[model samples]
Target: MANIAPPVEDIAPDALLDASSSLLSEHPDKDRLFEQLAISADRAAVAGAADTAVGLAALAVQVLEEIGGEPARLGTALAALGRLEYERGNPDLEPLERAADLCDDLDEPVVSATAYAYLGAALVALDRPGDALAAVSWSLAEQERVLRVQPELRPTLKPVRAEADRARGLACRALGRAPEAMDYLARAVEAALPRTPAQRLKIAEAATLLVEDLLAEERPEEAMPYAEIAITALGDGFAVKAALGRQRLIRCHLMAGGLAAAHPLIEALIEEARAVPGDLTFRAVLADSLAQSAELLPLLAEDGGERAAERGRESVAIYDELLAAGVEAEGVHTGRAAAALALAYALELCGKHADAVAPLREAVDTLERYAPGNEQLTGYLARALLMLGDALVESGQAMEAAEVLRRATELEPVTTPPR
Candidate 1:
């Protein structure tokens, strides 16, 4: 009898697992079991049940290994498992690496290309940019070969091409090859034109990446369109990526001196952020957004200083709450310090130098305590010290100002021409 795969989408993961076990014991059709498990795993992943997805993917891999006839199937299973693991934040590279090797042993260029592409993305996430570049290069080459033979597959492979290009861009950017990175990123954006809902999200992601790279390179004008594209493509989605796209759009407006345009978006962002429940990271992002908005407001309108100060206060308070809640993640400390610095800037803009002094001091102390001698934080620390010195001087503490200025100068020397 031929093996028939069951409809996995209609079943709950627990029910599917139970059914799968029963079928395996009664029928023992390994291929059908593997297909059911893999399809269920994909469905669970799409539904955001990551643990269930991973469990199902592992079972699929086990079934494939026991069947052991087709290297391509095993390779695909391993790649799927690795991708799920990477998305789950566990990121084991071995499976992706092994999958790439297994796929390479077959004459299936499309499967090999996809496996290599997955490996490349996983490598990029693991910070092995050199390996990522090589893997993606292989993937792209295989894709080109497949395209040469099967020209009809172009539309179907566009998303694959976009993903490979995006990974290539990221790897090139990490390797400091700016020109190549920009080219690849542009290609990714071009290839990711929306054909479906999933494709629209891909377009938003690609455009967001392009916007980030453009902004980092001090080309906000170039970034603006991509930022707009990302925001527009994201539509009504309240996911973190959607929020990030909106934030980047606001930043593009701010950098391009369109403070009026940024103001309303910032307000909407705050409102949206407030609506999000039980997400500490999103709250932290909201605090940072508030700080940026506060900084922008002082230059925007006549009553801007007062509104800026209020926003600054709110930003600082949020950071305080986060810190008090024991959220000791990677950027939380730095973000807290930045919030204090922004609040101090807002106070100084209001001509309350005395009021600014305390926050400036807090900013400096936060950095010194939490990230002592971190080279990456040295610039922020130095800027905090300089601002604190200025506030001290304005507040009639010339002696303390001189001491703080000396520390700032020691951390980041200010070059002066000979008189």
Candidate 2:
């Protein structure tokens, strides 16, 4: 019997298992059995059967250790386990780190690069973007050498290449390097096929980021296509992508004069955010969107005052909870400020003029404190000040109302319509 397995070069990963299995059954060879186990583990992993892959790879590791401390055999088994751990979102870095070290010591550049790519992905899951960048960049560098030596390695490198690009792009985006992030994400989308959920997720992420950039630049019309792409590619199972796609779609609807279409989606997103604990950003956006839609409620419904007040109270409560949780991000603060304005407006609608004053002042203070000199917030600030002035006048404080209204008028030209 041949104690050593043939080199896995030029073999398709999916075909490798069957080939090794045939060899193992015919020859009863330890090396063939180990290779079969490694290939089967990889097959499970690529099929999204992560737990099965871990078990198969663990068995292979044990067999290799029992036979002898064979570097190549052990390295392959360890890398398989490490890849599964990364996919499973394990926070502990020891498995991948150890696999990477083993592959490096074995002088197996392809396996080493795979290990590093997965390690970077794991680091990204851990929210360590800087370390993710370093790890993924190392993977890319190693892949460069491996490809140079064996150009046929390209097929085998696809998943690692795609993952490395995603990790790098996400890390760059987290660090505020938007252009670089977009470029990497674009490459990631190109590298991945939009077939499997895992593959489509990369495309969805890239498209969503592109849409957000366009929206931020006030090009909602241009952003529509990418949002459609993300929403379609993401399908139904992706909660984060679905929320983001719906969020962008609602904004596009509002900009395109389709408030009727936007209202229910906004409500749905708010309720969805309420159900998911860590989705504070989406909750803040839902609150902001609901506040924006409050102005249109009277036109949309006969019981608009009650409906708008309910939404405004919900928005305010969401922001309050976020603030109490120590979330001081600019997006959260902006949402809180916008919610205050909506709450004040809702109170005014219900004829509670004196009760509206506090939220109006809060809107003004939050806007000025967090978003100073922002043109968008300038309009909102002026409106909030005017609302405060009106509330004071209605509450029998004419002297104070005059000074507040004068400040409101002096801050900006009256570009905004009466609230």
Q: Pick the candidate with the highest lDDT.
A: 1
TM, every model:
0.70, 0.63
Q: What's the true lDDT of residue 80 in model 2?
A: 67
Whole-model lDDT, model 1 = 0.78
lDDT of 1 by residue, 161-257 (tens): 8878878887898898988988988888766654433445656766887888888776888998888877777665437877878888887877677
Top-TM-score candidate index: 1
Superposed on all Cα atoms, model 2 deviates from the true structure by an RMSD in Å of 7.8
RMSD of 1: 6.1
Taking every candidate in turn, the Cα RMSD to the unseen true structure, in Å, is 6.1, 7.8
